[model samples]
Target: MSKQLIIDFVSEITPQLIESKDGKYKFRGIFQRADVKNGNGRIYPKKVLEKAVAKYQKLIQEGRALGMIEHPPDGKTRLDEAAIKVTSLTMNDKGEVIGEAEVLVGTPKGEILKNLIDNGVKFGISSRGSGTLIKRADGTVVVGEDYEFLAFDVVYDPSTPGAFPETIKESREDKPMELTLETLKKDYPELVEAIKKEAKEELRQEFEERVIEAIEQKVSKIREEVKEELLSDPEIAGAKVAVEGILDILKPFISEGIAGEHLEELKEEIKNLKESLKKKEDEIKHLKEELERKEIALYIEQKLSESPDGDKIREAGILKEAKSKEQVDKLIQEFEESIRKTINEDKEPKGKGVNESRQKLSLSEIHRKLGLPVIGG
Candidate 1:
């Protein structure tokens, strides 16, 4: 026969602590503890649970972390039997699997669990999983490293020693829920600020990226459409010569020379055409040079304005390369990216990475995440 449902009941959620901080039915408690012998005469080592908790973190983030009202009928987490949305699960320095799960009050099993929390009925955290057991010489059973943490089932009876939440909730008894922003403000003000800061920064960055992406898509489409419309005159991008017709008219005539009186007329015409062509060529050259110079100057301004490394860049030969308009266009695309990035960096709040280490989610984020909204911060 397969292993019986291994329900390691660790703590009881007493009615006295049934306070929902923001109408979100949530609970904070230790699901399973390490190195603590329970009433079942079983001990779970820290190393064993550490690996399990680390593996189980994926489920929590995916919103698949679930629990049953009493216990799971089988090993797999069934959607029909699921009653809790296990959001935040982590191990503290004490080697305890600290967790915060929201009761799924919408489903049938959830309704039952909600009624239990509402009526002040006692419930406890029971971690369900399968693992090998080690029998010590003293007859004490230790949960081995093969332990696979499945889900946290909130139950009524706990078999672990001091399994009551009063033991686990010793530090957080006065608080409603740990993930709530209010509680975070009091306990970890810096982390709370970090959440707000990082949330805004990320949202802004995401919005900017999305907005820029959308604009770029639209611009690209319009650009393609314009290119198609101008396909007949690809040279429209360059200067339009009003006297171009004169060149077309004179070309055939110039190819065939005239004799008699028309010969003198043709010679004068050739002389005049040469001067006109030279003047036009010089004019076009000057305009092109002027445009290219401006582009190069603008490129240099944008590059140097970003940092005080103009001398270094010149010494490195990066800026000494061809400063033509075509090269400037590529440089504008490459180095000007810093302009947008700098603007975003300016909008970023101070102490940005302070909350990066913690895996715990915030209550609003949990609710926003639709739970423990990964819903949390």
Candidate 2:
């Protein structure tokens, strides 16, 4: 059974704006380094990279070093349409493999990719290969010898992009050379069993990590919802300071190592405290409303005493019926108008004195006295 492994690295493509006549963009950077821990926390040893050097050279010679824009190279079948082609590859003294490639502008996909690069779209290179992986006891994984070097494709996914030469140096001390068949059977009988056990344990650990992450996310969402629901209540909203203080006080006891029964008891206590706080808050709100109503009544009484028709307004019970200062002001105005009308009626002549004075005044005299021009004699 052939297991698949993909190694990705950041390859800087230096575009040749003036050197090349062919409208193709040129890129040259380290494609692979030996004995390096890649983004997946796995190391590719020197021997493995050395073996791939010749394979890549052969692919370059046969004019078959082609790769896609974003997708990985199809397995050993090697029948996928390509967007870029590798022209040269050379390994350095540091065991870092550097390569130069040109973006194929002839094909439709290649033209699109070239346009994207020219327009400043960032792209990185990723290598796809097939191989089995060996996980060490220290959690470092090594690619086996069956690894085959495949095409390097242009990708847009952002990753930790840097030369991994330091990683290569560090992996050398921790990871020893691979054991031969004779050494595996004669010297290390437990090697095969350990590998099997480690693989199962690694899978279980990965599953557990995913499950824990999902549970934490759900818990966080539920906590936010509960907080929002608590804040929506007017009584609770006013007591947010007290609630936060209580939560802070109880937070240390709510964590791991506390027994479930004890935790439930603490929760019940907190619940009782919250209810008691809410009841006290309700009492405070009712008292505040009563105090405000009494204040308004007192204000109305004071305003009535300042008015000239205070006795009459108080007799009508308007001051007591008024709900607000504005209502009391309006009632006072109405009472003052009634008092003024009564005074004016008492000051007027009781019999025909007023009617006789009005009849004595002639129509022309009235018009002239009122500063009007009389017409038609």
Candidate 3:
């Protein structure tokens, strides 16, 4: 079985214990384990194991944050949102809004620098150039190097608790420029529409291929119905033997892209499954035989208890093993006749005939003889 099958079986059986804190079935343990050799003698995927460990660590962190942890780790605590800054925004010549932020370090007024400081938080300082580059297949950078950039200022606030006593000021260097939407459509409309048309054609081709596939599936179904009808007619049976070959033809249509080695392995698996089913049936047959023997023993015991006399029991065919329904009926008729004969002799009848004294011997006894489990008796 595959590792996925093992996980599925575990989840289906005793889901509660294996469930994660997130209320979902988790394979954390499986992921954390080292690669093991499966029954097929192949090593398990090590990546699957590593993934489980990472998920387990994430769950631990979540549990710690939620206070569901029993013993939390003692370490330096880091706040995720402590470094954010508030500032003003201004649109530059390049259609980009520069967020001119300020953070107070020592006082409100300070020197503006481009370098980063250890304690001071710099927010909204850098102005990144905005443009898309179209590279060639030769790995060369695209043309249109006329891109423009913008600059912003960073200021600090010291009123908040634990705030650094330094004011951040960004450098005022290059001014911003813009490439407006109206300007692009007016001058570069041909280039833009050409790209759009190419994309539209590609989408149309993909949709056409899907339509063809759907029609082929409908055709395949119709062919299957006709083949079924031909196989059913005896007059066409001789000629229809070739129609069955249509299945072999269709097999390639369905399994066409499958690798040859994989197809061979699939056929071998079907053969193995047939062999396994045959073995199970053989085991059932053996169990049935043992059940028949135990049933006979039960019938004999019941007959003896009903009529204590030995001669009467022997004449009734009580000890005989009936292999068929006809044989059993004959045995019952003989027992009834003997009981009637005994009654005519004027002696008191022991109890009843073999049929009357019949008991339902549980199949459990047969299962015990065959070393298999039986349903409740």
> In terms of lDDT, which candidate is strongest?
2
- The parts of candidate 2 lying over 4 Å away from their true place are 12-14, 73-80, 158-377
TM-score of each: 0.39, 0.41, 0.21
Q: Which digits, one per residue and each the tens of the lDDT, describe model 1 over residues 279-371? A: 655665675566556556655655565553343233334344656756744644543344334334445455654233111322332223221
What lDDT would each prediction earn against the true structure? 0.62, 0.64, 0.36
Which residue window of length 10 is worst by lDDT in model 1?
A: 166-175
Model 1 lDDT, residue 100, Cα: 87
lDDT of 2 by residue, 237-273 (tens): 6455765776686677566555545767766766766
All candidates in order of TM-score, best leading: 2, 1, 3
Regions of model 1 farther than 4 Å from truth: 1-5, 15-22, 158-377
User: How would you encode candidate 3's per-residue C-alpha lDDT over 168-280 as one tens digit per residue?
Assistant: 22223223334465644543443356557877989977875676576557556655765675466443433334435544764875566645556566566555555655565
> TM-score: which candidate is best?
2
Better of 1 and 2 by TM-score: 2
